[model samples]
Target: MNKPERVKLFLVDDDKVFLKSLEIDFLENADFVVETFPTGELCVENLSKKPDLIILDYHLNGIEKSAMNGISTLDKIKAVNADIPVIMLSSQDKIDVAVDCMHHQAFDYVVKSETAFMRLKTIISNAFRLKKVEKELKWYMNKM
Candidate 1:
């Protein structure tokens, strides 16, 4: 018998308390090898880790106000590996923003709410399923 492999997840948020809480929640309950980053730059720099999923915050409250927001970060991540799934998170629930993220191929856009962690877990599972299916489809197509 062999243990199942843990999912590699990258979580990026500038809010210190919120980020810490999310880190603890996933570490406690999920079979994820989680890496937390305070800024999109840090996350992008570490993209070589090849995370299975990326959860990024729309608003980065870091010292550098010009740092990458979720959209730009998503673009950068896609540039690195278009196959990787990215979920955008924000306290703001603007329809336009969500639509824009969807246009850029975001796996999901989640508003930060009391039930955010639960929603995150659900989205993560769905994204992984989709990704796996996509990979298998690509392989099958190539074989034909």
Candidate 2:
């Protein structure tokens, strides 16, 4: 039997305790490779190492306190790697914010919940599988 691919997820949240708790959950239950950063700036700085997916909070402390807000951080990341999937987490219920995030090409926007976490795991696994197949097919085509 073949082993499953482990999903590499980078989590960015200003709340240190939240990040630590998520790191624990990802390790203990989801079997994912989780790296936690207290802020998006650090995550972006280290992203040259490249993570398969990113989980970001909508409101981050110490980020640009401007009209753009989370979109600014998201923009910085997307600029470097347009294809890297990003999932947004927010406690806010404002439709405008969610709409703007999705409009900016976030893979998904989610309000944190137990169900959401499980779904995140599933999505990560499926996305990895899809990307893997695409890579294989591209290689085969190049050889042909």
Candidate 3:
């Protein structure tokens, strides 16, 4: 019997309190290894580590305002690895914004709220499963 590979996740948010809390929630699971970044710039800079999934805050505040926002971060991540799934997070629940994220290939868009962490966990699990299926399909296609 062998343990499954742990998923590496990058959580980028400007809100320190919320970021810390989310990190704690994700870390509770042994299957997930969550890394926190205060700015989208930092997250993009560390993309070489290749996180399995990224949870990015849409409106990165303060100093981060001058840096990359969630949409740009998603673009950068896709440039590095288009297969990587990025979940966009925002405190504002706007359908247009969510649509914009989806247009840019975001895996999902989630509004920041009390249940955000729970939603993130579910989305991450589903994303990983979908990724596995995609890889398997690609391999099969290459074989044929």
Candidate 4:
């Protein structure tokens, strides 16, 4: 018998408090290895670590006026590795914003609210399940 690998999650948010709280929640509740980034730039710089998923704040420039926004960072991340799933997390609940993130290939968009953590947990589980199925399909195809 072998132990399963823990999921590696990269959480990028300019709000330090929100980021820390979310990180703590994930660490305490899930079998995840979490990394917190205060800026999208820092997340991009650490992409070499190859996190399984990323939860990025839509408004990343809140703390830094000149920082790259979530969409831009998302683009950079996709450019580096399109396979890595990224969930756009934002305070904005507008449909247009969520649509924009989906257009940019976000795995999903999560609005900041009391239910956010639960929603995120569900999304993460679904994403991983899908990824596993995809991989198994690819393997079967290759065998055939």
For this target, which candidate reaches the highest TM-score against the unseen true structure? 4
RMSD of each: 1.5, 3.4, 1.5, 0.8
Order of the predicted models by lDDT, top scorer first: 4, 1, 3, 2
Tens-place lDDT digits, model 2, residues 1-144: 999777688998876777787788789997678888877778888888788899888888644453234566788889999889888888776888889889888887877665667777777777678778989999999999
lDDT of 4: 0.96
User: Of the candidates numbered 3 and 4, which has the greater TM-score value?
Assistant: 4
Worst 10 residues of 2 by lDDT: 61-70
Q: Among all windows of ten consecutive residues in candidate 1, which has the lowest summed lDDT?
A: 60-69
Tens-digit per-residue lDDT, 11-79, candidate 4: 999999899999999999999999999999999999999899999999999978999999999999999
Candidate 1 vs candidate 4, TM-score winner: 4
lDDT of 3 by residue, 49-120 (tens): 988889998887655457777788788889989988999999888999999999999999999999988888
TM-score of each: 0.92, 0.78, 0.92, 0.97
Candidate 2, RMSD to the unseen true structure: 3.4
Off by over 4 Å in 1: 61-63
Model 2, C-alpha of 142: deviation from truth (Å): 7.0
- Candidate 2 versus the native: TM-score? 0.78
lDDT of each: 0.90, 0.80, 0.87, 0.96
Tell me the tens digit of each residue's lDDT in model 1 across 1-144: 999888999999999888889989999989899999999999999999999899998887555688887788889999999988889999888999899999988999999888999999999989878878988999999999
Residue pairs in collision within model 3: none
Q: Kindly report which residue stretches of model 2 are placed more than 4 angstroms away from their true locations once superposed.
A: 1-5, 62-69, 129-144
Error of 4 at 39 (Å): 0.4
Candidate number achieving the greatest lDDT relative to the actual structure = 4
